[model samples]
Target: MHIRDPIHGAIEITPGERRLIDSRAMQRLRHIKQLGFAELAFPGATHSRYAHALGAMAVATRVFDAALREAPLAPAERGRMRQAVRVAVLFHDLGHPPLSHTTELALPPLGALALPEWLVDDPGRQASHEDMTLKLILDSELASVLERSLSDCALTATDLASLLTGRTPPSGAPFVAGGVDYGPVLRQIVSSELDADRMDYLLRDSLFTGVNYGKFDLDWIVQNLCHVVREESAWLALQRRAIFAFEDFLLSRYHMFMSVYFHRTSIGYEAMLRRWFEESSDAYRLPADPQAYLGCDDVELWSALRGSASEWARRIVERRAYKVVYEEHPKDPHQAPAVESALRAAGLPVIVRRSKGEVSKYFGARRGIFVRTERDVVPVESYTPLFERYAEAAVLVRIYVPPEVREEARTVVARVLS
Candidate 1:
C-alpha cells in the first residue's frame, strides 16, 4: 500500500504492516488528531496520528538503510534489525489517548496508572503514552500479527515493544535471549534525541500547520547518519560534514515550539480543555484500563464536551477560547504570585500555565547526537554553544483571561510585574 503523505510523499507499507494498520487499534488513530486542540489555532493541523506513524516508519526505514551500509552485521542480522526498527516506529504512538498530550495531562497522576514495578520508584517516570503503547503491542491483537509476521526474522512482540520503548540493554550485553545485540542502535533509531520520530514529526507538523519554522535538511541528516560502537554499545552518529544540518534540525525544532506548538492561542485552547476536564463531573471520566482506553478518541471526547453543561466545554465548542493576557519566555518564578494577586484584585478570572521548552532540554541534556569526526567521536554539545545556552533557560509562562477581561488582566499583570 502506498500512502501519499503531504510531508513524506509516497510511503509504501508492506503486507504485514498493512495488516497491523488495518487492526481496529491502529485505525482508531485516524480519528485522533495529531495536535489535539492545536487545530483550534492552526486550522490546517487536523492531521491524524495514523499519518505520523507511517511517516515515522518510512523515515526509520531510510535511516536504518543508511546506517546499515556502515554497520558490521551479517545479511540475516541486518534484515532482522531492519524489520524490528520498522515495526517499532510504525506502532510507537498506538497508546496515545484522544487529543494526545492534552488528555495525558488530564489523566490521573502516575500512581493511578497500572505501571510496571520497575518504574514505581520514580513517580515522575511512571506510566505514560510509551507505557500504554508497549502494553497494547504486548497484549493486543497487534501482538499476534507482529509475532506471525516476524517469525522468519526471529523477532517477537517483546522485542518490538522494547525497541519502541527505547529500552537500552545493559552495556556490552546481548539484547535478546539468544545473544542478538541490535538493541542499542535500534532503540536510538526509534527514541533518541534525533530519532525518526522527531524527524518525521518536525516536518509533518510544519507541513500541516502551514508554517516553515520546522523545515530542515532531512535528507542531508539521514544520509549522513552512521552507526558506530561507542562506550561498548552501538550508537547513531552523524558524519562530521553534516554538523550544520544537525544544528539546523535543532533550531528548526526550537523555532517550531515557539511559533506553532506554544503559540499563545494554542496554549489558551489547551488550557480551556484541561479546565473542562478538571471541572466536569464524573460522567466524562477516562478509562484506567489499557483496553478501555483504546476506545477513546477525539470524536468521543468532542461529543462528550459538546453535550456537557460546563461553561468551559461550551466555550471550547463555540471556539470562544480564553485570551492570552500575558505571555513570556523564561518565566519569573518568584513574581507569579504577585501577578496573580493583581489580576484577582482587578476582578479578572486568571489561569497561569508554565510550559517547559522540552526540545531544548531533551537535546541539550540527553547526551546523544555525537559527531563522528576524523579524530574521534564527540558529543555535539562539545562543539555547539547553542545547546548549553538554551538548556539553562527557564520554562515559558502564559497568563490567560476571558476575552472580555483580557485588557484589564493585561494591565494588572504589567503593573504587578513592574
Candidate 2:
C-alpha cells in the first residue's frame, strides 16, 4: 500500500505492514489528532496519529537502510532486523488516547492503571501514552496481529514492544526466539534522540501548522548516518561533515517548541482542557484496563463535552478561554513569586505558568547522538557550542486570568514587573 503523506511524499508499506495497518487498533489512530488541542490555535494542525505513524515508519526505513550499509550482519539477520524496525516504528503511537498528550495529564496515576509487569518497574512514574502503547502491543488484539504478521521473521509482539521502549533485551530472554537479537542499533532507529520519531514529527508538525521553524536537512542527515561498534556496544553515528546539518536539526526543534508547541494560545487551551478533565474525571473515568482504554478517543471527549454541564467544558465548547494578562522571559527566577503575589494583592485571579526552554535535554545527552570522527566517535555536544549555550534556558513565564479580568490583571502584572 502506498500512502501519499504531505511530509514524506509517497510512503510504501510492505505486505506485513499493510496487514498491521489494517487492524482495528491501527485504524483507531485515524481519529486521534497528533497535536491534541493545538488545532484550536492552528486550524491546519488537525493531522491524525495515523499519518504520523506512517511517516515515522518511512523515516525509520531510511535510517535503518543507512545503518545497515555499515553494519556487520548476516543476510538473513539483516532482513529480520529490518522487519523488526519497521514494525516497531509503525505502531509506536498506537496507544495514544484522544487529543494526544493534552488529556494524558488527567490519566489516573500509574498505580491506578492495571499495567503489565514489564511496564510496572517505575512505580513513581505516571502512566503515559508510551506506557499505554506498550500495553496495547502486548495485551491487546494488536499483539496477535503483530505476532502473526512477523511470524516468518521469528519476531513476536514482545520483541517489537521491547524495541519500541528502546531497551536492550536480556540475554536468553523469551522475546529472543531462535536466538535472534536485533540489538540496540535497531531500537535506536525508532526511539533515539535523532530517530525516526523526532525526524518525522518535526517535519510533519511543521507542514501541518504552516510553519517553517521545524524544517531541517533531513536527507543530508539520513544520508550521512553510519553504524559504529565501540567496546562491544553498537550505536548510530553521523558523518563528521554533517555536523552543521545535525546542529540545524537541534535548533529547528527548539524553535518549533517555542513558536508552535508552547505557543501561549496552545498552552492556554491545554491548561483549560486539563481543568475540564479534572472536573469531569469522576463522571468520565479513564479505564484502568488497556483494552478498555483503547476504546477511549477524541470522539468520547467530544461526546462528553457536547452533553456535559461542567463550566470548564462549556467554556471550551464556547471558545471562552482564559486570556493571557502578562508574559515575559524572566531574568530572575525569584521574581516570579513576587509577580504572582502582586497580582493577587491587586484583587486579580491569576495563574502563573513558567516554561523551561531547554531543548537540548531531549536531544543533547551523552548517549543522544554521536559524530563519527576520523580519530574516534564523539558525542555531538563535545564539539558544538550551540548545544551548551541553549542546553537549559528559561523561555517564558505567563500569567493567565479570566477574560473579564484581563485588563485589571495586566495592570497588576505591570506594576510587579516595574
Candidate 3:
C-alpha cells in the first residue's frame, strides 16, 4: 500500500504491514492527535501518531539504505536488518496515551501490565505508554497478528520487541553478518538521539504545526550515516563531514520545544488535564489490558471530560483553559513561582508546568556513538562542543491561572515584573 504523507511524501508498505497498520492498536493512533492540546493553539497541528509511525518507518528505510550503502553485510542480512529497524520505528509509539502525554498519570503501576520479565525495569514505577506498547506486542493478541504478518520476513514479535527494548534476543543477537553483531546498530536507528523517530516527528510536527523551528536537513544527515565497531559491536555513527547537519537536527528539536511544543496555551491545557486527572482520579483510569487499552484514545478522554463535573475538566471541555500569567525561559531569571503564589493567594486556581527539552540525552551519544573521521574514530562529545552546549535541559516554566481571574492574574504578574 502507498501512503502519501504530507511530511514524507510517498510511504510504501507491504501487504502485511498494511494489515498491521489497520490493526486495533494502530487504528487507535488515528483518533489520538499527535500534539494533543497543541492543536487548540495551532489549529493545523492535528496530525496523528499513526501517520508519524509510518513516516518513521519510511525514514528508517532511507537511513538504513544510505548508512549501509557500502557496508560488508550481505544483501539478505541487510534486508532483515532493514525490516527490523523499519518495523521497530513503526511501533515505538504504540503505547502513547490519548492526547499524547496528557493522561500518562492515569496509567497503572508498571507491574500491573502483563509484560515480559525482561521488559520491566521496576514494577513499582508508574507505567508509561511505552510500557503499554511493550505489553501489547509481547503478551497480547497483537503478538499473534504480528507474527502472522511478518511470517515471510521470519522475524517474530519478540525480535521486533527486542529491537524496541534495545535488548539482545533470547540466545544471540538478532542480526549477525560476517561475525559482526548488527543488533545494536539496528536498535540505534530505531532509538538513539539521531533515531528515525526524532527524524520523522520533528519534520512531521513542524509541518503540521505550521512552524519552521523543527525543519532541518534530514536527508543530509541520513546521507552521512556511518558505523564504528567497538568491542565487537557495531554502534551508529556519523561521517565527520555531516556533524554540522546533525547539530542542526538537534537544534531543530530544541527550538521546536521552545517555540511550539511548550507554547503557553498548549501547556496550560495539558496542565489542566493533569489537574482534572488528579482531582477526579476515579473518573478515568487507563486499562492495563492491551485490548481494553485500545479503547482509550483522545476522543474517549474528551468524552469523559465533557461529562465530568471537575472544574479542570469543565474548563477543558468548555474551551476555557487557564491563562498563562508568567513564563520563565530555561535561562531567564526565575519569576514564575512568585506569580504562581500570588495567583493562589488571590483565590485563583493555579497550574504550574515545567516543559523540559534536551538535545543529546536519548541514546547516550557521549558513549554509544562515534564520529568516524578520516584519520580515526572518536567519541562524539570530544569531536564537537555541541554536547556540552546543550547538556543543560531547557526548562520552560509556565504559570497559569483560571481564565475568570485573568485581570487579577495579570495585575499580579505586572506587579511582579515591575
Q: Name the top TM-score candidate.
A: 3
Per-candidate clashes, comma-separated: 0, 0, 0
lDDT of 1 by residue, 1-418 (tens): 7989877799887787788788877898998899887887789999999999999999999999987586667788788888889888988898887888777764544555555554344556435676677667776667777777778888777667567655542332324323435577778889877889899999999988999988999999988988766555676788989888888888898888877888788788888888887777833666656568778899999898889999998998898888877666674446776777788888788889887664455554554667889998888778677786676644677778888877777778778777
Better of 2 and 3 by lDDT: 3
Each prediction's Cα lDDT score?
A: 0.78, 0.79, 0.84
- Whose TM-score is higher: candidate 1's or candidate 2's? 2
Which residue pairs in model 1 clash with each other?
Answer: none
Best lDDT among the predictions, by candidate number = 3
Q: How much does each candidate deviate from the true structure in C-alpha RMSD?
A: 3.0, 2.5, 1.7
Q: Which should have the higher lDDT, number 1 or number 3?
A: 3
lDDT (C-alpha) at residue 302 in model 3: 81
> What does candidate 2 score in Cα RMSD to the true structure?
2.5
**Candidate 3 lDDT, 1-418, residue by residue in tens:** 7999887899999888887888888888898888988988899998999999999999999888876777797777777788778778888999999899878899999999967777878999999988888888887778888888888877888888788887765566777788888788888888887889889999999888888999899888888898877778788889999999988888898899888888888888878777777778546789898888989998898888888888878888889888877888877888777777777887887778888887767535444677989899987778888878878888888887777888888987898788
**Candidate 1, run of 10 with poorest lDDT:** 169-178
Q: List the residue pairs that clash in candidate 3.
A: none
* Candidate 2 local lDDT, 1-418, one digit each (tens): 7989887889998788888999888888998999987888889999999999999999999999997686667777778888888888988898787788877765666766665556577766667888778777877877888877888888877677678775544433422323443466677798876889889999999999999998999999999998766555567788999999988988898888888888888788777777776667534456657778777888987887778788777877888888887677746446667777887888877666777766566544446567888998887778778866776686688878889888887777778777
TM-score ranking, best first: 3, 2, 1
Which of the two, 1 or 3, has more TM-score?
A: 3
In angstroms, the error of model 3 at 180 is 1.7
